[model samples]
Target: MKTKRIILSALRSLGKNKLRSFLMMIGIIIGIIALTLIVSVGFGAKKQVMERVNKFGAESIMIRAGGGVQISQMSANQGTTTLKLADAEFLENIIPEIKGVAPFSSKGNTDIKYFEKSATVGLLGCTPSYAPVWDWNVTAGEFITDEDMKLLNRVCLIGTTVQKELFGDSYPIGEQIRIDNIQFEVKGILEPKGTSPGGGDMDNRVMIPLSTFMRRVANIDYLSAVKVLLHNPKEINTTAEKINQILRERHSLAEGEPDDFTLITPTEATEMAEKVSGTFNLFLALLAGLSLITGGFVIANIMTISVNERKKEIGLRKAVGASSKKIVLQFLFEALAITISGGVIGIVLGGAGAVILGIVMQIPVSVSWASILTGVISASIIGIVAGIQPAKKAARLNPIEALK
Candidate 1:
């Protein structure tokens, strides 16, 4: 009952100086807002990155020709030319966990023409198994076949972007298009794949037979990369190691020599994204923590000033038989009231701001209840820490000295 009275008295005292109370809460409000936004944005970015990584199929692996540091499966190679169709075939035969392999070569920014329209687009040469390996779908007609590869047929599949640029809405299947001055029939239209993880257009290319690419477009015997699909995604690391060993033996590399090719799995890609997101989140958390600490100092200063201003009140309460503990509790409750109120408001405002920012910036933002709870709890802790010294000072004041 005495505690209840102390709390009520604290509330009444705070109510008498609403502006000062609100000012004291400003730091806490800003800190909680920063913390909440950081958490929500970090979660959303991580989720988006994972989704993008998974789009390449979690059960798949990619082998690109070259050595040195490689961040993603899509990383292009220039130094090594050892990776070939034979290497892909050998790995598939040796690794029982391998489901399928699609060896492909690419020519970048080649001028392709149909009728009077022309566009510079990427030219990919892939085998019949490429569709199944990448889980790609043909919107119209059929993908590359063994017969086309065997005959080195001039049949190609155009992506939606190419189709739109060349044929517009008109059916492109069976239509003849000229790529690098070589005429080829459009056998199929690729389904839209939107954008790559690197923000490049996925559906802005053309795919032809691997044999045709080797003989005509790129004029290279070596493959650019090999897409490998695994029966079990969990065995990605083991399978990748096996593939590395096989490739090393085929290339006849001696002990301690750096690999001539790079192998990347979906798991690796996801881990990279996770690491990047974690770093970003840590940086954001540190900044927010600094803001919170600054806010704590503000609260502490305000509470100290309040203690000085209410010296007479403290003396009056002590003269009326109120215990020093009651005075301490009263000041602590007042600080908590200010911080808690600010935290609540900050949470609402922060969540709303995150959503608006996400929408405006076209970035993903997901607010969780855990983040909200953390903000409120952090505010409460800051309040307690900030009020402690002032509370103690107020409690220790002599009644006569305070009254004087």
Candidate 2:
């Protein structure tokens, strides 16, 4: 009953100066808002990144024609065309862990024309296994076949972006498009893949037979990269090592010579993405924490000021029958009321802001219950910590001295 009265007294005291109470809570509100936004955005980004990384299939591995270590997806050395079709065949035939192999060469920023319409797009030459290796499916018609490669057929598959650019609403299949003045029949339309992890448009390319590209366009036997799908994802490291040993022997690299090819596994790609996201989230979290600490200081200052200003009220309560413990409890309860109210308001505003930002920016935002609980608990802790000294001071004031 006495505790209830103390709580009511604290509420009444805060109500006396609504503006000051609101001002005291402003720091906590900002801190909680920052915390909620950072957590939600971080989670969304990590999820989106992981999804992008897994687009290549968790069991897949890529061997790019490069000498240096490949840290990022877009950093693979495109100039080094050491990888060959024969190398892909060799790996598939020799490595028991390999399920599928796709050897492909690419020429980017090439102009394609269908009558008056034209678009600059990427041109890829790949085998039929490329589709299965990359988990790509044709929305219509079919991908390149072994016969197409054997006969060096000038047939191509266009991505959705290229389809829209060149053909528009007209049926693209059975239509012919000229690449560098050479006409190739469109055999299929590829499903939309949106964007690559490197932020490139995945559905802005045209794919044709490897032989056709080699004979007509590139006029080179070397491949740009080879994608391999493993029987099991757990064997990626072992398979990569075996592939490295074979390639080193085939290339006749001496004991000290560096590898001519770079091996990139899906696991490595996912790890790299996770590491980047984790670092960013950590930085944001630290900034939010600093904001919260600053808010705590603001709260402490306000509470201290309140204690000084309410000295007479404290003395009056003590002159009656109120104990020192009750005085401390009253002040603590007031601090908690302010912080809790601020935290609730901040959470609602932050969540709404996150959703609005995501829609405007075309980014994903995921709000977890954990974030809400954390924000509330953090606010409560800050309030308690900030109010402790002031509460103690108020409790220890002599009735006569405080009254004077």
Candidate 3:
């Protein structure tokens, strides 16, 4: 009952100076808002990456032409020609876990035309194993064959987006499309893959035999990447290490020399996501920490001033038999009330901010229970730490001198 009275007394004091109480809480509100945003964006972005990795194939690994570069290896945007089809074949022949290998090269934004209509799309040159390796079979007609790749045939497979853009509802299996002024017969329509992890449209490209792509289109003898489908996912790390050693020996790189090729597995994809999000989140955390510290100092200073100004009130309460312990609790409760209110407000706004960011950035964003719990705990801790000195000061005043 006495504790309830002290809490009520603290509320009443805050109500008398609403503006000052809000000022004390503003810093906490901002800090909690930033903290929640970091968690929401970080988790949501990581979820997006993991989802793509799952879709890409849990048992798959990719070897890109470049070691490391600014552009992502997933997008098939690497310009290096260090990786080759022979390297892919060599790995498959020796590695026991390898089920299939599909060496491929791609060129983004390739211009193609169908009669009067034309569109720009990704152009992929892949071997016959591409279908089984990717688990992505054509929905209609037939996929490329060894004969087509061997003869450097101009046969092609079109994705749904390309079909919709150039062919529209018309029967497209036997239709011809021109890529780089070279007409190719459409053998099949690829199943739609929707959006990629990096936000590119996966179903907006054309696939042809790698031989045709190298000799006729790009005029390159190198591969952009090699996709290896493993029989056992549990032994992936060992398999990847074996692949690395083989590639180094083939390339004739000395010890300690950087690898020309880069390996990307499901685990590496997740780590890539963590590194990206971790770096940005680290910066945000510092900002949030600074705001909380500033808010703590604000609370401490405002509260200390409030203690000095409320001398008459303290004196009257002590005269009326309010104990020193109750005096300490009352002031402490006031600070707690302000911070708790700020935290609630911050959480509500933070969730809304996350939604706004999702729409604006066109990426996933989610608020978790963990973020809310963190906000509540952070606010409470700041209030207790900031309130101690002021509460003790209010409690130690001489009743006679204070009343004067």
Candidate 4:
């Protein structure tokens, strides 16, 4: 009953000083907002990283032609001739860990036309191993066969986007289309994969046999990149290092000289992407920390003023036999009540902020109990830390002196 009175008295005091109560809670509200952003951003970043790693293939590695250049930094035309089909052949034969290798080249925005409809799309040159190496298969017809590679047949596989653009609701199988002035027959329809690691539409490309692409289309002997799959993903890094060493020896570069190729593993790509997002999250964490600290100070200052203003009230209550512990409890309760209320409001506003952020950045953001709990805990900690000194001050007051 005594504790209940203290709480009621605390609520009455807050009700009488509405503006001062709001002033104390403002800092907590802002701090909770920052904390909410941290949790939501964390959720979004993790999901995106997983999706990117899955798309890149966890059990595979890519050997891009350009040396010393990061996969994300390499341009379309930076193809180096040092990494050849021979290097791929050697890697296949020498590396026991490697399951398969698919050497391919690519060009973007190549025009493809059917009867009257036309669409420009990204083009890829792929071998038969491209299917199993990537675990990507056709939805309707067959992938590039060994016969297509041997004969350099002008045959192609169209992605769902291309199929929709050209064939529409009609069947795409056996449809003949012109890929940049060369007539190619569509042999298959690719599964509708959503987007690439680079954020391009994965369903917006055409796949042709590597031989045909190199000879009939572009007349290039060098491959743009090679995708390698592993029988055991646990050996990916070791295999990558082994392939790197052999390629260095085969290319005949000096002991210290860099090899004319870059090997990108799924783990490395995931780490790279996380580094970018992690740095951003770190910055937000700092801001949240700073805001909470500022909130604590704001709360403490207001609580001190509240203590001073209620000195006479405290003295009267003490004279009426209220204990010092009761005074402390009342002050603490007031601080906690305001903070809890502010935390709730901040969470709602922050969740809306996260949704807006997701729309603007084109990333997925989720609000869960984790976000709510984070906001509540953050606000509560600030409230307690800020309430302590003022609560102590109120408890230690000399009733007679305070009454004066």
Highest TM-score: give the candidate number: 4
Error of 3 at 74 (Å): 3.5
- Per-residue alpha-carbon lDDT of candidate 3 for residues 1-404, written as tens digits (9 for 90 to 100): 29998999899999999999999999999988998888888888777887888877789888888887432446664667778889999999999999999999999889999999999999999999999999888999899999998999999999999999998989898888899999999999999899775578989989999999999999998998888999989878999999999999999999999989888888878787789888998999999989988998999999999999999999999988988999999989998998889888988898889889899988788799988998899999999989999999999999999999
The TM-scores of all predictions, comma-separated, are 0.88, 0.93, 0.90, 0.95
Superposed model 2: Cα runs more than 4 Å off: 1-4, 69-71, 74-76, 359-364
RMSD over all Cα atoms, model 1: 2.8
Error at 402, model 3, angstroms: 2.7
lDDT of 1 by residue, 90-195 (tens): 8889899999999988877789999799999988899999888888879899999999999999999999999889998899999999999999999999989987
Per-candidate local distance difference test: 0.88, 0.88, 0.90, 0.88
Ranking by TM-score: 4, 2, 3, 1
TM-score winner between 1 and 3, please give it.
3
Q: What C-alpha lDDT, on a 0 to 100 scale, does residue 81 get in candidate 2?
A: 70
* Per-residue lDDT value at 39 in model 2: 82
What lDDT is obtained when candidate 4 is compared to the true structure? 0.88
Clashing pairs in 1: none
